[model samples]
Target: MFYRIPSLGGLSPFVSLLSLALLAHNIDAASSGVINYGGDVPIGSKLVQVHVIYRHGDRNPKSPYPKSHYHDLKSWPGGWGELTDTGILQQIKLGILLKALYGPQNYGLLPEEFNVKIYKSVTTDVDRTIMSLIANQAGLWRSLKGKGIHEPDVQWNPTPFRVIADNKYDTIFGQNCSKAEKLVDMFRDERFEQLKNENLQLFQYAQENSGYEIMTHPTQICWLYDTLTVELLRKGIIPEWANALYPEPLESFLMEYLKAGSLTEEMRRLTGGPLLKTIITAMKNLTMGKDTIKMYAYSAHETSIYDVLAALCSPPKKPPGYTATLLFELFQYQNSFFLRILYRPGPDQTAFPMKIPGCGEQYICSLKKFEEITQHVLPKDLVAECTV
Candidate 1:
């Protein structure tokens, strides 16, 4: 069910799951203005606006578990939780990809010059995220040399990114929400306990290898797995103690742990509400011809991307990879407007259009339908609900 498109340089763009039959023959046909991915686009559709939410790229482990034996923990160049040079490069590549997709001569969705009125970027006020945004912007506009205004050697343009205040409920990551905390406390219940008990052997194996007593809590275990996984990738060597640990079951448990908050309708509404509301409002503003901004970018965490995916009724197939992106695109066809959801699994992958369950096939739906189907999960009042 996946389709592959050859890149301009003859490299194969990553495979996408959108049906090949839905693609257009003329990718750059100006009349329709459809931004085709390997010739895939809804017939007669013209690209209008795009909103992207993405996780920061590769980074040093955020923290080590108590009594941890992670060897590289003390040697990471940026220390713990900060972006590494590799992380910057990952995001830079992503920015280059974005330029190819949306820059003026390509999709014509964004202007060549840096215009504050046409683009807005937002990021969680974290060092990694802010640095990622900077690196991404460098690649996004790498080709544009500002109208001979700056020094002749300058190849970069400033793309303003607003950093959301820390400790605010506006972003769920790294924030303290009492209600969300209370709801998440359900992991301590008997049901989750049974789930943990079923995986006791795996937990013990992880503990033995990690040099730490593995906590039975879902998030705690998930954190351990995530930290270790990244470390393994970075080090390119698996320790002898980890030989007995099976990766699949541990990953499943970690996914379950991460998704625990969105397992129920009420929890989904509470955890993902504010972000959903922001996206909906932006969509509304675009459709009404009131918003001039062509692209809105958010640099955030994996949890933020996952929660938004769950809110859209499209839980991610796996944890979002480094620089994983979720794009909400608004397309205009004559007098009608349609919305398409696309996901890029990583900086190296092609973006696949995603199906919004119950909305429609082809992964494209009427704007009204998009709103209707998503309304139930959108929080009516985030502050009031977050405290409940």
Candidate 2:
């Protein structure tokens, strides 16, 4: 017998061991609760356009911890935070998956041929993300170019994608807010107490070894976690304490820090609300025929993923892994439009349709109801909200 537990996207988050054993043996397309990646269309609803936000692939640590051992720039050939070879491959894999799922033959969300007029992509002004987009495009083009298809003789052409400027604010990036800064300070103090009381030995060890500088901000330890994780990935040298307590309490602490940085209503408004506002505006524009683009893709960070999900009332339980994606699909049905949001946890994982809280158990939400339920999370005037 199989039991189900509540989870996002209508799939049970937890399953009994017997359920797992059953799932392992009886894998088929017809199984209830099983979502076929290519078969998620809502009844009688025709797909309209798709919007995607994905974290960059694996990379070296953006910054080293205090008294860090992995300081050599040569150690990371791509320099600080640049995409590694594995990162490129990861994005390429994602691109191929995108083509399989959204290309003309499947969901028909994207054009068969690469068309600047119908497709749009945006990324932050960062090297890893920029390269990841190019890599993903390469994967898509490769799929289009090979195997008894059109454009076999055509060499891969460059795809146009915009990059947000440093001083400007966009849907995926947060604007400056004194309130957010102060919240970070508050989170730092809170984490210090929690650590000192709960894991004092581990806390004191990481603190003394990593240096005091990293403890200045609540999110700084995440950098240290990054460094450690990269080393663990490479099978490089790591401290004994880290080997014992590295990913368990350390990862949890890092997640808490990330979540705490945007814990309050005002903090979420400044950090995550802009993206929701943008998405809503896009949906409204599509419903009104103002938007001609068929696909909108944002190549961004895990924080970007977190920002948007938190805005949607589903803050991530763990850090979004490399190539994690949030897909928002709009559909038209009988002169009305509805929405379907799915989360692909990793590059290789199947996309799970997210059943948004208060949006009911149904996977498809009408655009009008979506705008109504999401009003509390979408900021009215983002700039004004950020100021003072």
Candidate 3:
């Protein structure tokens, strides 16, 4: 966690001093330390650039399910409906926080300024996601108004943020399977059938058990065939060897197989489940698009976040909000673009490394250094923070 001198006055001096000492010791472990984000910004201005992936504010379920497995949206104290009164209040307060932090002039935004050019795209899910997008933006709109920016020309266009329900979702293992799948297909010719036959045992069970989902077992299959086989050849799981092989197909899933233990651990580490690349693609599109976009917001489930990180082959550290919102600032610097991550603690409103159920607010993880497109993959030393 990035340790900070207390900005509030509630703590006693002695407590503060002790906290400071402990923070100094732990800061290096959690994060190297906040980068002085001065030089890296556009034109070297320390102006803030924000990208937020927020959950919809408090709201009722879209509809009552006759036999639902998830939590009841109606049971949320508010009627079976849109954002509750409290939710609107929550979003409005967030607006206040935004103006306070980013400052109105930073983005040339305004309070009473609801008309800012904010480009927004949301997943085409049910009401919660769509409502959350509307409500969260409303919060910012209200907040922007306080800063003199009135109701902005908010656009809620549908994007490919949602999973494309097809054979691919039910199939495909590891990340970058689009590339991996191509690699696998190269061996389909008759000349490689002999080699394919050698590996047929690996897929034999799936073919026999037609009901079995090979895609569901992508990591396991990759683990047994790829990582494990490679480790067996080396006779040990050394870090250097692991790193070299991780770029190969199915390696990401293989690593997970080696780490699995408790279900809780699975949930904790499985922040980005499957659809990682889609999120990255959407983010990239937003930045490159011509919308004069001030803020780009994503309202998705926890799995969406996890999958995006995985797809990016990003360091595996996940965001911290319950319905965490991760803000990424896409800045064009001297013909290059740099991304900065701002994590918001959520549904509860906190920042990273602070402990909240299903949230890790203790530290902020950024690829600010690795976020450069040229250095998409991380160096060895930074491996611990991410799965990639």
Q: Write the per-residue lDDT of candidate 1 for residues 77-110, one digit (tens) a residue.
A: 7778898766776776666566657766566897
Question: Which rank order by TM-score, best down to worst?
Answer: 1, 2, 3
User: On a 0 to 100 scale, what is the lDDT of residue 289 in model 1?
Assistant: 82
Q: For every model shown, what is its TM-score relative to the native structure?
A: 0.83, 0.82, 0.41
Q: Candidate 3 lDDT, tens digit per residue, 1-388?
A: 2233344256543232222221222122112322223222345533223555555555544343222222354344544545554344344344334433443533433333444354444443445555455444443443221343232222221222333232323221122334323333332222234433555554445223322234343332432333233233223342342343344433433333322211232222222332222233444555467345455455655445444444233323423223455555555545454455555555444443222111122122232333343133222221132232
How does each model score on lDDT?
Answer: 0.68, 0.69, 0.37
**Rank order by lDDT, top first?**
2, 1, 3
Tell me model 3's lDDT, rounded to 2 decimals.
0.37
Q: Higher lDDT: candidate 2 or 3?
A: 2
User: How far does residue 119 in candidate 2 sit from its true spot (Å)?
Assistant: 0.7
lDDT of 1 at 201: 75
Q: Give candidate 2's whole-model lDDT.
A: 0.69
